[model samples]
Target: MSLFTEAFMTALLVGAIAAGIPLLLAGLGEQLSEKAGVLNIGIEGMMLSGAYFGFLIAWKTDSALLGFLGGIGGGMIVAALMALLCVRLGLNQIVIGIALTLGAEGATALLHHVQFSQSYPRLSAPMVFSIPGLSQIPVLGTAFFSREPIVYLSLALVGVFAYLYRRTYWGIALQAAGDKPAALDSAGVNVMLIRSGAVLLTGGLVGLGGAFMAIVGAGIFVPFMTSGQGFIGIVLAMLARGQPIWVLGGAILFGACLSLTTALQVAGVDIPTDVIQMLPFAAVMLVLVFLGRKANLPSALGAAYVRGAR
Candidate 1:
């Protein structure tokens, strides 16, 4: 390929990978939660919360790692609350989730005000380094080996999750809980504990995705920084039919949509930015409407499991 072609391909790949990171992280997290019969609608709010909290902590402590941790911590806390509302109180999952999202958003906005007063410093990370010997290759090198530590970490988690969900005992238990909770409960499995763990995992992963945005993508936190990645993730989780491998594929498709929108603007397309931006959501709506009736969710999904009760 010519130098120009090579460079363009490299750029497109980089953008797609960057866009895919958040979706992959968030979708995988949701996959875990949904498989355990929990539907978390607060992912969007949790992501936003993480971005603000993580950015502020990193800025104050001057530690990118700490900021990332803070993001996970923030997300987990919210998840815990959701668990209490849904699992402990036996409240409606959808209603509790919507409430949690609203509460998380208000809390994040208030916290942002208190931290910045008016303006906050951008949360920055150290320069991403190329791996030794491996980063010297052509397109793949730039796409993978030259990225930040977190990017690699994200990809590694994908493989790890795929393995666990497909190969491990815990994975089987989780699926059983979603498919036939009564049988699993009779077998002495703790259904509530399984559900709780799923929620916490979802929160942490989504939060990490948000931290990536503030620290690496923009190097700053603004209100609603996560945009709609969390909601997109929920759609992706459904589209993937609770399979980790398909989540990766679906995320890439969405990432391609994202990349195309930006690439069009950069190439001086005559369409309005809003028009391009709407494509993803429009597609999401179309797909959901078309597939909603056909999609077969877990038999126990959206129904709280009641032990010793048929």
Candidate 2:
């Protein structure tokens, strides 16, 4: 059997898309939070919480849709706390974010041990939707056109977010909240409300990403399964420079590297698995090193906003 068969290459592309979706969602979510002046370092926690609850719900109920919703709720639960402490009460964002991640790690680990340590289970394969004409194309058809519905929805969100940033009043307000909260407050806009809303939406998107990881990407949930994807998402968002399209491009790039790593392993490359696993991170960092100097972050990101403080 030839290693570089058409089937093998097609599978690699599919794997890339699967791996990229979580990063895309997380990056998009991080972009929204940054736009609202919140540096969400706890995004890892949100994704982990989403994975746990999403998988639990899906396993118990056998419905992927409800699992995804549960995942969203799980992420939002953490985000609400972030908003309350960091946005509403003006706590230290970095400290609170790290604490949240630690809390989530411990809590999910305990829950998984209690529930599934003895009998680890996995879900059935998720349903895939193949486009009529597009699915008929050569290798690209199966690679791009035939995927779970969430894949399509995640891709569409790129366009939706781009529109929100470019052609909407809310976008301007988000920019104001991040760039100049005092000015936005002076204009009678509820800066806190906008920021809080962005945080919550961030959680939802990140949670959905977690759900995709568990329900579709891996078909199972493990504690600490996010494994720094959230942090990578942050890098993607920062390097995107407020462009959703750029986030998409970065996510795809990372995903392609991941796929390449797997392909190398399958082709019997004599490399350490650990070294092979480093490919994606190394590739992303190389991009960062080259382009990060030009990345334009929000001026007020990570700064707490007080209503009237000068």
Candidate 3:
């Protein structure tokens, strides 16, 4: 079989889209939290929680929609704790975030061991939604236009988030909370409320990303399956500098790199497996090294807001 056959290319592009969706979701969620002045380092935990619960629910109920909802709920549960400890109680955001991630890792691993250790089960292929005319446009059509419903929703969210940030009152409030919480508070806007809401919403989005990974990307849940995608999402968000479109671009780039690795492996490239696996991360880091200096972050990011305390 030719290495670059139409079928092969199509499969590669499809894989890239599948991989990119989770990162896109994660980056978008992280952007929201960062805009609201919360670092939200515990996003990894939220994603993991979402993956486990999402897969479990989908497996048991056989409903992808319910599974996605369950995933959102699982992530929100962790986000609630982060909000309480870091945002509400004025604790160390980084410390709390790290703790939450470690806790989630252990908890999910234990649960998987207890429940799924006997027999590893997988989910069926998710339902797809193909655009009528567009789906017939050769390889690119199927790669881009025909996909799971969640893919379209995830892509649409980029535009939705961009609109909210650029032309809305809530967007201004979120920016104010991150940039100058005291000013927002004095202006009668509840800074804590804004930040807390951002964190919770972030969890839901990231959780959905996790659910996508288990139910669609991998078709099964495994311990620590996120593999630092949350952290990469953070990088994408920070480099994006509050631009949702940039986040989408970065996610697609990383996803393409991931697909390239798979393609190389399939072509029997004589390279170490570790090196192949490192392509996506290495590509992101290279971009970060080049562009990170230009990133403009929020002034009060990661700082807990205290009323009247300069």
Position 74, candidate 3: lDDT: 86
Candidate 1 off by > 4 Å:
1-4, 265-270, 281-293
Model 1 agreement with the true structure over 135-250: per-residue lDDT tens digits: 88897799889988888888888788888888998988889878898888888889988888888888899888887777777788877677779988888888888778888887
Query: What are the clashing pairs of model 3?
Result: none
TM-score of 1: 0.90
Model 3 lDDT per residue over 1-310, tens place: 5678776677678778988999999999999999999998999999999999999999999999999999999899899999999899999999999999999999999999999988889999899999999999887898899999999999999999999999999999999999999999989998889999999999999999999999999999999999999988998898798999999998987887777667566665566757756887787678778865767889999899998787
- Total backbone collisions, model 3: 0
Off by over 4 Å in 2: 1-5, 268-270, 288-292
lDDT values of the candidates? 0.80, 0.91, 0.90
Of the two candidates 1 and 2, the one with more favorable TM-score, higher being better, is: 2
lDDT of 2: 0.91
Backbone clashes per model, in order?
0, 0, 0
